[model samples]
Target chain A: MDLSPIWLTLKLAAITTSLLFIVGLPIAWWLSKGRSFFKTIVEAIITMPLVLPPSVLGFYLLLAFSPQHGLGKLLQDTFDTQFVFSFKGLVLASFIYSMPFMTGPIKSALQQLPVSLTQASYALGKTQWQTFKSVLVPNIKPSLLTAIVLTFAHTLGEFGVVLMIGGNIPGVTRVASIAVYDSVERMDYAAANTYSLILFSITFVMVISVFVFNKYQAKSPLE
Target chain B: MIDLSIEKRLKAYRGQQILKISHQFTTGSITKIYGPSGAGKTTLLKTIAGLVYPEKGKIVVDSQTWLDTDNNINLPPQKRMPGFVFQDYALFPNMSVLAHLQYATNDMEWIKRLLLLGKLDTLTDHKPIHLSGGQQQRLAVLRALAIKPKLILMDEPFSALDPDMKTELIAELKLLFKELAATVLIVSHNPQELEGLTDGDLYIP
Candidate 1:
């Protein structure tokens, strides 16, 4: 089995996880603080990808980014780029697919915070961003870390969205899951075993590490 | 100088009617609002500080109108410079007591003096959630004092303490408030704690 697909999956998860932190943190903050009747509706929309079938999302994305479409045309005209059937397209799909995994922990964590914390920061003459950085975010470090780890892990296991839009191109769009599927389809059990075993061990280690490390940290006096 | 007459209805569970009352909190003086629980005491403080908006009323602080119904002016909470402390002692849990003091001002000597005055020297690196109830209350008072605002609003400031702790904090707060001469509005439901702790009158529900 080619390890390139495994490497690409890791790269995609890392980049998407990093970018989602920047986008999702403020949104989670706003939802945590702002009051509105439409809060549920807005929240539903962000987490829509969680319930929406990945095939449907991939179908829509393929249409929107097919180079002949409007968004594709605009991107091509402006940046001389095409997105359909590419690694970037897979990454974008995974980002959308895994957004709720990031937002869920963050929103719940932030919602549990006391208003007095923000009030104290405001009373101390700190700006909203300053307060978020110095007070709110730091206090919610465990949640933020959860968001990162969950999003990355979920993105790593992504299959349907990557398969539909990625077209299973070798090394470029052939992520580990897709490669496993390809090996299975071609009756190559050995290759499939190699890729599947690695994916399983990596995922197992990640999840176990999260639980073990959290337990260790909890037991340590430094925590 | 802060002048505010706030009124807002907060419908709590079991039909308890909590309202921000229309009463003048005198400017440039320590005017206490003494009320029982669910009497809208905390709401009044929040409304005066612009943390909560009154459905209809006005708040004039230092000659600058913060919230007025007829004039249609309601400033946000951040723009209003009021040092407020809640019942739970609203110190940032992520910050040390020293950082909390530093967030308010940068005068190290003044901070050290304030720390010594409040006897918070040993608790400098402690977070709010980790501190004892009395220590947290003292920290809250010091945090407000550090801001040096024109006015301060405290909701049941000394409620979470033993008698001795309460007496000590009240004494320290009185000295500091008298020294700075900053206007203060403290809510108190504890009548016994109010007798010697407050130098001002009460607004009972």
Candidate 2:
């Protein structure tokens, strides 16, 4: 088991989760608060990555981020950087692939909430942004935690999208899951087994952590 | 002072027709809304809090326009400053008693007041879910009060409590509101039930 691949997986997960949180928060907020004809369409599109075949997502993502497409060419021409076969490309792919995992819990939790939580803050003469940052975020703690863990874990185990966009460029886009596949193909079962076990352990820990936190919340003093 | 003349069509799925009701709350006094199960009590309270938008009308609280459907203006809940406690509404699951109060303003003195008000001094460190139902109801009051809004809206705040706890809460509220001169609006099935808490004015529908 090469340590580089392991580190790369962790890095990918971190970058993807951080990026998603920045954009996903507003999107989830809108879904919970607003009603529009396009709202359902937007939600379905966001969740498409979850249900879509990983390979199909990878294929479209590869084309979308490549220099051939408008977005990809714009990024390259403007920033003097290419996304394909790069760490950035891997992050972008992981972000799209695991978006639903990040947004689903957050949206549901926000919806389940009463406007009272945020209202309470505003009534105290606080600004809306301040209220969201302080009151809403802290109140929806478990949902945000769940979103982070699921997105990170999902990004860590990602294969298809990374395979298409990242192209297995060692030391750059060669994540642990891909390395595991490469190892098995090369008849290195021990290395593959090690990588597999690590991924499993990481995911197992996240699931267990969620359960423990929920149980703990159920016993909170402010019930 | 809060004044709302809002008309909202509430779509109820439970065999009740769409409801269109318009009401107003005047300034500087406790207003109790008494109605049967299907009456517009909760809707009225929530509208004043900006949680629900009325179909038509104007809402002016303390000279600020909150909602004017004719003028096409509706402020979201985050823009309104009203302490609200819906029936059985609990504090956030992720926060402890102290953390929940932190939203009101990280002011330690006010937190202490709330802790003492609800007899929650020892439970300040505990999470909301860990408390008993009675404790939760008490915390709800303290949480709403901690915000120090000009007005407070409670939807059947005492409905679920045992008689002893309800009377104790009402007695406690009388002292608190009279001392602060706060405007507390309550919605209940039995408008006359909470005599100890009110100033002896009940508006029944």
DockQ: which candidate is best? 1
Clashing pairs in 2: A123-B81, A219-B130, A220-B127, A220-B130, A221-B127, A222-B127, A222-B128, A223-B128, A223-B129
Clashes within 3 Å, all models in order: 0, 9
> After superposition, which runs of candidate 2 have C-alpha atoms over 4 Å from their true positions?
A1-3, A68-71, A188-191, A197-223, B1-4, B13-26, B61-65, B73-80, B105-117, B160-172, B196-204
How would you encode candidate 2's per-residue C-alpha lDDT over B68-157 as one tens digit per residue? 988888877667767787675646666788877786657789789878877788998898779888777777778788777677888877
lDDT of 1 by residue, B1-205 (tens): 5556666777776775647555555555777687666777888888877777777898777688989988889887678768788788877777898998998899898799779866889889988878888788878877877877778888877777788866776777777777776788888776677676555666647
Docking quality category of candidate 2 according to DockQ thresholds = acceptable
Q: What's the distance in Å from true for residue A107, model 1?
A: 1.4
Task: Please report, as a residue range, the 10-residue window in candidate 1 chain B with the lowest summed lDDT.
Answer: B18-27
Q: What is the lDDT of residue A39 in candidate 2?
A: 95
TM-score of each: 0.92, 0.83
Worst 10 residues of 2 chain A by lDDT: A214-223
Model 1 clash pairs? none
Candidate 1: TM-score?
Answer: 0.92
lDDT of 1 at A144: 75
